[model samples]
Target chain A: MFPVFEIFGKQIGVYGIMAAVGFVACFLVGRLLIRRYDIDIYDFALTMIAAGIGMAIGASLLYAATNYRYLFYGFSHFYEIGWSGLWMCVKTALDGFVFYGGFIGAAIGILIYTKCAKDVKAHRDHLLDIYAVLVPLFHGFGRVGCFFGGCCYGIESPFGFTVHNNHLNPAINDVNRFPVQLLESGCNLLIFLLLLVLFKKHIMEKRLIYLYLLIYPIVRFSDEFLRGDGIRGSLFGLSTSQWVSIILFIFALVMLPIKTKKLKAQSAQAAESDAD
Target chain B: MEQQQGKKGFAIASLVLGIVACVISWWGLVLGIIGIICAVIGLILAIQAQKSYKAIGQKNGVATAGLVLSIIGLILSIIGTIACGIVCAAGTAIANDSRIANQLLDQISSSVN
Candidate 1:
């Protein structure tokens, strides 16, 4: 529950610290991989920057969408509250963001980066394979941050530790709750390791990204059930993330075969050309 | 070859900036903010370095390390800023509430006396 800590009279957020650590770890690991694969570092840096921007935008937009009441209230009372209030409302809206939105945004960013960068476009499959592993590695750190920040808490459960004075969510306070954040973080780490091993072994080839898409959605779909927070909107009796997971899972399922077939065809053509 | 030499200079500069950013990030919010700015510039330099390296068919590990460190510094600084904001807001709210409570108590005592 230690969201903020002071050092040398300056407050530091644990979540931010963890995220920073994650980003560094991801970058270092990915750099090693880029070297191994002989990928273009400049293109990698550009793609990362694009993805970071996209994630920031997507996360904030989705947060605002899910918490529409805040916007409605702010708009309705805009005249009465004036500029300072409106500014505060905007600040508040930007503070909390959904991870799924960031994920989707990053994917879109990578796609756009690939389209624009000719060198990266040529090595899209390999880059995507690296990205697939990076996502989970970064996300795992984020989950740890969530746990310390006392956000995205799980339902009351006698099996887990009780939280006290949880500043982020009072509902989670004074009750034993499942450590869903830690569980998810652990799961993500496992997935990262698995993907890394598969990648090193050259097991899945170009289908690695699809494998991640297929696997993570299922984990997320089930994990949503354990999640206690309702800040992330719901539709048709399922949370926004759950719905997104289902959609993504289906998309991955459909795209897997198509992409595999396309790759096989391309390879066959290359082989024939080489033979000639 | 000249441009390649210039790129190497950028890579070294980026690496130095990245290290400075990461170190200064822990000092204070103001320093952290400066670190973030430095990190952004460092990242740009690292990218340039990488592009140059690619042109020369060489791998620039220093540029990669610089890019990684810079990103980490930026994230830390941003988090430090948010933490400061939250703490400040909470402090202000508490002070206001205490002031109102003290004023009410003083008024009650004066009236009773």
Candidate 2:
């Protein structure tokens, strides 16, 4: 019902609009990072444009795939399947946006673009450091978009934070859902601010990105419990994302020590070479 | 010179093949295997060309193109595989439901008669 919005014969949805708003916010934040850090990646706007195109394509593809039944059969076979059929499919896929899919897609896009540039490979360390911070800032915008679209609604709660009858979908009708999306958006905003503060103090580098890798998965895993409509099914008695989070958390922890050792060794070598 | 061009041609051909595989079929196990091949070759070429570009004090636009194309191709193929998974899951669900429904209806009819 809250699917389409028409203005001057042009149609849009809260999902798409909020996504765009998120992108704009990300662009502005990226611009701020550029000025603060003296990053010399192409003009900020061009980078934003390229990233925007990549995220848009990747997000829509993931959404369509995750909800393939709704996207193809439900929407296309309306005459044969009827409204109920389509509704079921839509409800099935409307639980939330797939974050892993978006993360992987955007990472590939940024890595390719950066590697292709003439100077980027030479400045790989600095470029990566800057990107580490930018990722969370941009991700914060996406969580906000998720909040407005009401896709990742929360489960029932006695707390007053529950959202009732969002009207975005029938499946979540009259339930006091947890507002999990809002919680995520808030956490991401805090993470973004923390990254900003760390970057200002110059205490962040590759380590900062590692922190994000640790923090986001933990947040997502905890929030997974509150999600009412999405893929909450257990795999080995744990939700899929929670399991993934556990795996990723361990991976990040293992990598942290290795990364720190590598950095130290490199710095020592540089110092010896400089003395020579 | 011709061999290098041929190699570049081969890489480009694979990249295009991968893209089409991703766009049309969008989901299949085989597409991912092929996509991996395309991405690997493309990545190698891109890195090699980048080294050559540095040696010559210039940029390698062709190699960059290969990298970008291969990356997009890889992403699309991966997406296609995921789509295939969702399709399989939905199909299985519907099939199971129909089977259960028919069984229940048969049991009820037999009992009533």
Candidate 3:
């Protein structure tokens, strides 16, 4: 119901506000981390700009590509088309932003920016750690937006959520639907908090960022099952994302032991050399 | 030697992004090539950056791993590309056949009328 909040003449969706909130939260976290580790602010600013723009463009493009039907379909009836015209296409393109797409896009933007940046402080691990934490936190807000907009609705359940009646969204049928969007947001928040704790304990290194990869896909892959939207697809008896998750999880597990062993060996060598 | 945190951050970001790219575009041939290129290029740059940092007396192996991850991403991207192509072609074929069936239905209805 509150998906499209009218502010002045413009309509701002909850998703957009959530995105802004995520950005602010990320900036604050980044600033705090940079200050703690004596990282340069300019570098943070540069990377944020690159990543933010990348996420936006990437999410939008992916949404348009994946949901091409709804976006491309003129309308089942002439009366519907008469009201919107091609403007609906443009609107749908903008509105169908996907989270995974944005994540990849932002990462690419940061990578490219890092490659080109000339500043001395641009390549700091502390900055990376801050980003690592921020990505999940901000993405959490985006999921909340999804919930508010009723875009990523859940399946039927006995005691489930109902979309309030409003101009922007009708009361969604099926009361048995699980609040999957909220569940996702909750998971993301938990991850963010966990990351914060690790950072506070000074246990985080650049390697910790890779843990995000291992964790997020697992959460998303599981959540795919509860999603009521037509987005879920099973490939060879496993959900597409779940299949990807299995591979990524296996890869992470394989790498973890080796990485730990390598670090132990390196530290041991250092200790021996230092003693000599 | 203590590695500066900044260089490590850059490397990690590059590696994560590279892996993500490989996974996302894994459904398309062009995207797979691009993902591999990104991963490779990212890995090389990250490695160079890590080396430069180490040369200045900062020991940051984490950054080095980021470079290595990018290479892994490149391999995964290639695999993803082949998978994506097969799926896409199959999907396109199915959609085309469906469209033809729909057209035939319309034609049959008109003839009967």
Candidate 4:
């Protein structure tokens, strides 16, 4: 796991670089999809940027929130600690980020974008379907980055591989662990492909986002069990992400019915008006 | 037209706050904190303006700019705050450590004499 390496005598994180790559890839693919749908490319770009900003804030805030006890302890012991200690505290607080937080943040960003961008506002549902496709596509790359960064690692297994001299998490060093990151990455890629196929076939239409919501939460909940990292925080023997997954899954289930009912009502009303 | 003006006002306010936040972000810790607060408020106002524009079937360029700028300013302010905190903490630690070391040397020398 090569977390950091030098490029032209400058240190760069593999995770950050991969995430950036994923962002660019998402934007490029999004542009293509938007063009195909006859949506304004510029507006798509702006919305994508907004989603990126939201993702950054949401991810960091969730990271900090999950480690709230540590942050509070740091603040409480602020007067007693040296500069190094303070640096460590702040660094830790800023380092780890949760993906669910980013997803929620991006959703908010899209909402804001829909308001701000005229064309996007007019075609919000279509754009959101595209956005749903992009999520797993981007996340797939991010999980690969996590693999390279040696974070979000899996539990020990005889069939797994060992990571040696891992500076990021020394606890996992020399320990044979399940390759959970790779597994998640593979799963995400499959999901991305499945969504793309659904999109192409026009099967779900505006309900694509709901499909993602229904699918991803189950995968995340199951994958959480294989995750070895404790920094994600846990409550009642379930990790934070697991709890979020449960909520998202149930929310999706409830929303699916309501959305179908509303769509039906709208179509019925349109039909009645046409008959008149 | 009146609602449009209201939306414009919020957009302008958001843009101004966003600019101020970015400008003062790197000044100091307190200023960075202020910048962050301003950015957050600007973001909220920008969202409100965007919502208003959507309801009225219009798009406000200024509001979009405000939202984007506010996000930038907020991120910069947060980074600035962390950087400032780290530098000050490191300086204090180095100074305190050196001072303690000096005092210990003086005590040892005086006791020997």
Q: Candidate 2 residues B40-63, lDDT tens each?
A: 455445554545455556655566
lDDT of 1 by residue, B10-102 (tens): 888889889888888877656876887788778878888878877877887898888778767677676775331232122211223556434
Once fitted onto the true fold, the runs of candidate 2 whose alpha carbons sit more than 4 angstroms away are A1-4, A35-37, A41-96, A160-168, B1-113
Judging by lDDT, tell me the better candidate of 1 and 2.
Answer: 1
**TM-score of every candidate's chain A:** 0.94, 0.77, 0.79, 0.93
A161-191 per-residue lDDT for model 2 (tens digits): 5334444444445656666766888888888
Lowest-lDDT window of 10 residues in candidate 4 chain B?
A: B84-93
TM-score of chain B of each: 0.69, 0.49, 0.52, 0.70
Q: What TM-score do all the candidates reach, one by one?
A: 0.80, 0.61, 0.60, 0.71
Name the weakest run of 10 consecutive residues (lDDT summed) in model 1 chain B.
B84-93
If candidate 2 were superposed on the true structure by all CA atoms, what would the RMSD be? Answer: 10.4
Please give the TM-score for the first chain of candidate 3: 0.79
lDDT of 3 by residue, B1-113 (tens): 32543466577677676666656544544566577567756665565567667557676666666766775675555334321111111121122354743453344334433
Score candidate 4 by lDDT. 0.75
List runs of model 4 lying over 4 Å from the truth: A79-88, B1-113
For candidate 1, what is the TM-score?
0.80
Clashes of 1: 0
User: What residue pairs clash in candidate 4, if any at all?
Assistant: none
lDDT agreement of model 3 with the native: 0.62
Write model 4 residue lDDT over B42-92, tens digit each, in one string. 887887788778777889999999988887787666555522112111121
